[model samples]
Target: MPEPNKDEWEQIAKDYDEKWNYLHCIGALDSKHVQIRCPAGAGSLYYNYKGIYAIVLLALVAANYKFTLVDVGAYGKNSDGGTFERSEMGKRFESNKYAVPKDKELLPAMEIPYVIIADEAFPLKAYLMHPYSKAAITSDEEKVYNCRHSRARRTVENAFRILAGRWRIFLKPIETKPEIADLIVLASTCLHNMLRNTSTNISLFEGQIRMESEHIHGVANLEPIRRNFVREVAITRDKLKKYFVSDYGSASCPWQWHSIRKSRVAPRRVQYYLLNTRIRYNRPF
Candidate 1:
């Protein structure tokens, strides 16, 4: 492969690699489905991830260490992991997206790469991997593979924490012109990167207040996002080594945060209902 040029390759290297220095044998990946009020005369073509009509924001994060952002792909309704893979970053990074260059020195190589954490809903691709199912493999091995993938992939969950944690914009349903949705997403990401780069020295509590005020939502009080982040982290760490082996069927992926909604009929049922749901938690790319 040719040597990296300072302008182009250096930016790519920074965006793809050094930013994720904390990650190990894991990559954080997930998707966030945001509600966008549909346009007039449009059917439910944008309806997705959930029964409701909305656009889904697909994101990737670095897991295996400190939580960090990798990349994000935005799409309309009816999009799944397969659908989001149509994004430029997804096509470029996914092992199955294109021919894998034999030259290991390519960007995919220079870093310490690993698995991606995903829920049962996502289909498994080679580099963007998942766990074995009871029907697909022995239960014992399935749990083993799952636990390994979970550990490294939780970073994306944490990245979502940083997002909803700071930008309350994601806390509610967002509505805009279909074409403008991607731009809003890009703006959120730009702010995220900007804040992430600005060094901070405030105390924990002070910092918490600052973020809450800035993002406009007290996400720390949002029990579901908080709980899922913790729950997924635990699931990812148990018996992890087994999933890391090459001979085994396990794989890795670019990671992101997943946003899921919970439905309830009553006030009491609302809190409990939202908390018990398995279907939605922020999943990343």
Candidate 2:
């Protein structure tokens, strides 16, 4: 099957922006292990952390739970980030082969390149965003960024869960050759996209839906936009964080503050959340 073209990616980005309240987001990338019996002459090549023999199915899922791009047949032993780097999709992205559209604004005067969101397993780059590492997140800004990023990135996981739920075959180890398993995975994703396109009311897997906020959300939050000196000072590295804690954004996520206040257990992550909550609620303690 042919890969999605540039126009298709742009359309997907528009859809994602609408659904996730995040602008300039093209897709969400993730991977899953598809269990298979060990192949002959390959002892540990397929062994993964789950203590099973498998192949990795790396995918870029759109906001609507459709699989826009997929790469299969990587060794299960590889980390998700490594598997992604070795995949054809990754190579193309690195080379700019797809010619993804030029940088666009997530908020007025705040320009950012179209990007794909991934979990902490992937590296942060110009075109891809991964959450702040729990170890390095020092301030409320990073904490809010991590929470918002993870919230949007969750769609890819939901897409895979919905696919696996619909196709029971993936739940069990397939006793087939690696090559055949790859074809099956490809076909399954194709069918998934087909069904999503044809049906309007398909029930998604039961998952938590975060409350939608009015503020523009994205990784571009780190970049300060300068329209005038006044607006420039207002839009700093923590512009997104400021919105999340502002009157309009703060009222939309009271649950976050309540949860943060009740949990004092530390490892710094909790402290980060508490700081964010305190700042958002205008309560220092």
For this target, which candidate reaches the highest TM-score against the unseen true structure?
2
lDDT tens digits, residue span 129-208, model 1:
55444344444444444443444344455566566656777777667776676677667766765666574654464456
Cα error, candidate 1, residue 281 (Å): 36
Model 2, residue pairs in steric clash: none
Give the per-residue Cα lDDT of candidate 2 at 146: 58
| TM value for model 2 | 0.75
lDDT (C-alpha) at residue 144 in model 2 = 62
Q: Among all windows of ten consecutive residues in candidate 2, which has the lowest summed lDDT?
A: 220-229
